[model samples]
Target: MKKSIYAAMLSGIVCPGSGQIWLGKKLLGWGFISVSVVCILVIMDQIISRAQVIAEQILAGNIGNDLTSIYAAVSNVALDASNSTMPALTWIFIVNWGLSVASAFWFGAQQDKQLQLQADSKTEA
Candidate 1:
């Protein structure tokens, strides 16, 4: 397979920035990795905190232990407007993944072109 295609696939399938790392773009790859990690951490923290709150309510008898009650609590948490960070983090993670894929493909294609040029020059000489 072409390096560009492979790199793009790796980035998309594995983790964002993995393709860039495969393409020897350590700085760019690490940058994407860091952003992705931060987004993931923040989103997870928000979700876990909400879950803990619901669990506490259930234990305290504020919320019933029934499935319906649990579902409603989850729904309320999902629709909560005060926690807008989750949506923003999700979008940022998605955008970062896309950018990493594109960057890996572009850099790989450039490398391929350079190699082709070198091969052509050698053949001429």
Candidate 2:
């Protein structure tokens, strides 16, 4: 059980939400995947929109000698998007992955304990 939990943690580290799948929880696995997808899409949209705006400005000749400043501002916006969303998603992944691993261990330990109790009762009989 410990081994399985550790394996699930490793899987999650490699790919977000894979730990739930490893633990045989398809619904949770899919939920995690969907949330990740939505986050990525939102971040991508922000980045693309900002970039397009910068490009349009450059094409319209508004980016005169201050092109460097314009570039810097656009870069800042991109980084801000990452700063806002990436950390949140990363933390979410870490927490969920850890919970999945712990749950696997707990489930196995409970089953083993129950079996041990049953065996002990039979011996007493």
The estimated TM-scores of all candidates read: 0.95, 0.57
- Candidate 1 shows a clash count of 0
**Which regions in candidate 2 have their CA more than 4 angstroms from the true location?**
4-8, 65-67, 75-125
TM-score of 1: 0.95
- On a 0 to 100 scale, what is the lDDT of residue 49 in model 1? 91
Model 1 agreement with the true structure over 7-120: per-residue lDDT tens digits:
889889998899989989989999999999999998988889999999999999999999999999999989989877888899999999999999989998998889889999
Task: Assess the local accuracy of residue 76 in candidate 1 as a C-alpha lDDT between 0 and 100.
Answer: 90
Worst 10 residues of 2 by lDDT: 1-10
When summed lDDT is taken over every stretch of 10 residues in candidate 1, the lowest stretch is 80-89
Candidate 2: the clashing residue pairs are: none
Model 2, clash count? 0
